[model samples]
Target: MSQPVAPKKLRVRGMILTGGVAAITIVGTRRSNITQKKEVIQDAHYEVDMISTLETRRAGLMQARQQWERKAKALQERIDGNKLRTIPGIGGTNGATDGSASSGK
Candidate 1:
């Protein structure tokens, strides 16, 4: 029993470490990259850069959540609320383009 428990504990600990690293890398590293990508040489430039950064962050977070929901759905196919939540473009009923508008339209 002890021998079997040791391997299970080790695997669980390893999974936790992997999840932590993935979370940090996905959010932290992408945030840093966005910071490096934006250049604010003028007032309008700063506003545009900041707005774009915010939008990117929003979209990234939404995508992450939707991915999580997809995984949840996969693991438990009968989760009720998510079935109605509509993840959009990734196996959910609604597409992401449903309410989007073009800049000049």
Candidate 2:
């Protein structure tokens, strides 16, 4: 009967070294990929926060602008009212009466 032969020591050592190198390479690649993904997530979060802050500032500015526009409109209306009151036969009876009294004199 033929006996089974064991593998040579040099071939066994070479195979172990190759397997160890392959494992280290795979682990290193995975760690690099995980780090890149974390960075991407952080960047996305920062962008979202920036956008939120800008939107809040814009909304506040718009509200302030609306208030200023309202105040300006009210002021313009008051000015127009004063102008009408000063003009003859436009808003006040005092102007008509004074004009008639002056014409009669």
Candidate 3:
């Protein structure tokens, strides 16, 4: 009976080297992908934090605007009241300019 043929050593070594290179390439690609994913996650977190901060600032600005408007309204009303008092026929002033009563001749 014929003997079984044996595999060549040089061919086996080449195949092993090719396989090692392929494995290294795959591992390197996966590592780069993982790094990119980590950066994306960090960016997303940063955006969320920034949005929250901006919203808080906006709310504060809105509240301040409302307070300012209320104060302005009150000031305008006071000015209008003073104007009415200064007018001749509004009944706001007694019309005694020098603390003396005028008599009609």
Candidate 4:
């Protein structure tokens, strides 16, 4: 009887194929990580811009509020001055300034 033919050894080819696949996987993973980092940076910049815009709007509103308060105070002072002018001896210490004291029974 003839000797059994030996089985072919495929170890070297299998190792090369595995190494190629591993290199591709490693490169793909690195690229994906870089993409994720870029997206995070962009999102952070967008949030900063939104906060800056809000601060600018808040400053404008505060200035408007202060201006309105000043106008309201000026108007109140004018009204108080007019009331003082219309009333005679209001807040005076003398008792005769009051009408009831001046009129004899």
Q: Which candidate number would show the highest TM-score if scored against the true structure?
A: 3
Best by lDDT: 2
Q: Specify the poorest-scoring 10-residue window by lDDT in model 3.
A: 1-10
RMSD over all Cα atoms, model 3: 5.8
Angstrom error of the Cα, residue 22, model 4: value is 1.5
Query: For candidate 4, what is the TM-score?
Result: 0.67
Query: What's the count of clashing pairs in each model shown?
Result: 0, 0, 0, 0
Error of 2 at 53 (Å): 1.0
Which residue pairs in candidate 3 have backbone atoms (N, alpha carbon, C) closer than 3 angstroms, thus clashing? Answer: none
State which candidate, 1 or 4, has the greater TM-score: 4
The TM-score that candidate 2 achieves is 0.68
Full ranking by lDDT? 2, 3, 4, 1
> What lDDT would each prediction earn against the true structure?
0.80, 0.86, 0.85, 0.84
Question: Which residues of candidate 2, in runs, are more than 4 Å off?
Answer: 1-7, 87-105
Look at candidate 4 and tell me the lDDT of residue 19. 99
Ranking by TM-score: 3, 2, 4, 1
Cα miss at 33, model 1 (Å)? Answer: 2.4
Q: Which stretches of candidate 3 lie over 4 Å from their true place?
A: 1-7, 87-105
